[model samples]
Target: MGQDVYEELEREIALFLRRARAISKDFARAVHPELEADAYGLLIRIADDGGARGTDLADYYGIGKPTVSRQVRLLEELGLVERRPDPSDARAAFFCLTSEGEQRMERMRTARRERFQQMLREWDSGDAEQLARLLARLNVLFKTPLVDGP
Candidate 1:
């Protein structure tokens, strides 16, 4: 791509990130009045993973142990997360969502999906599918190192 194309892509990506941050804060507030915006990802991760160790969460998110621990503590206080002892390891505990957390997360996810569907209602089905495919591809590219780019 040309320098102009790269610059445009960077601008678009920056805008997307800003919008996403705003949405995340709104979504977190919708989940619970007291939930922090930054803790939203932790909630989603625990919900999706079924359960996760504190160390695993820290590692996966590239966050420090103290940060994860503090977030976990806040979630626990909010009654959104709970700890269960690892079946095979007496010293290890796994964090999972409470019933309320699960229900709230599911509802929020459903609402977000419906909103997306409505937003794309004007587009052809094929176009919407292609957009989803391209977004997924872009996310995968971000996760992997660039092999032939500056």
Candidate 2:
């Protein structure tokens, strides 16, 4: 790639982080009348993988295990997630979505899909799909710069 291409990529990555953080904050602020970001995240994880452990949630969210443990405790109190003894490791715990959590996750998915579709309306369908696939493929290899977002 040309120097300009690399420079542009860096600029876009920075701008994307800026915009994504703002959007996530706004999203959290707007929809938090029902659930906060951590709760919503746990629900999504459960919906994605059928269940997760506090450690898995911490790893996935890039947060500390103690943070995830606190969130899981709150979620359990809300009756959105239930913990069971891990069959593979009796001392450990696993969490799954309750029926209420599933319903909330479906609503979250619908809202997210609609918002993204609206934002991506100018893109060709094939190109959008390719971009999404590439982004997913790149996700593990790319880490956000520490200074980018709050």
Candidate 3:
């Protein structure tokens, strides 16, 4: 509520976003050769949404439709995702992970979890639980506004 609190939150949030992006980029580079941040994020969104059209993905990611279209084309060329005609809407296409993509994602998620588990080796369960609770509360406190769909 205080000005000081707001400034501190802004600084902390910026640092957190930077460091988190670096870590994700590192992990992504290991899994995907020369993976762009936007492309990697699109994969995550497709995984989250079950399946989504390029227009929907652009809106969800707050990016331009042309950019989403380009990324989807690259992803398709790389065999990472498949674009199929939308069953409900014949004129639209939706993206879904390919088998190789799902396999790769599973491996990346497993490796990340293993790394976290190793780091928490000496941490008490109660401490871990407390940290999770606090982070969840913080996430709720700073939730971003959603950009309207395209």
lDDT of each: 0.88, 0.77, 0.82
- For model 3, how does the per-residue alpha-carbon lDDT over 31-56 read when each residue is reduced to its tens digit? 68867666878887787677789888
- As a whole number from 0 to 100, the lDDT of residue 47 in candidate 1 is 91
Q: Measure candidate 1: CA RMSD.
A: 3.2
- Quality of model 2 by C-alpha lDDT: 0.77
Instruction: Give stretches of model 3 more than 4 Å off.
Output: 118-150
Q: Kindly give the number of clashing pairs for every candidate.
A: 0, 0, 0
The predictions' CA RMSDs to the true structure, in order, are 3.2, 3.6, 3.9
Instruction: TM-score each candidate.
Output: 0.85, 0.78, 0.78
> Per-residue CA lDDT of candidate 1, range 1-150, in tens?
689999998899989999999988888998999988878889889999898898889977768889998998888999899998976686988899999889999999998789788989999999999988999899877765556677
Tell me, by TM-score, which candidate is best. 1
lDDT at position 119, candidate 3: 82
RMSD of 3: 3.9
Best by lDDT: 1
Which pairs clash inside model 1? none
Candidate 3 at 41: error in angstroms?
Answer: 0.9
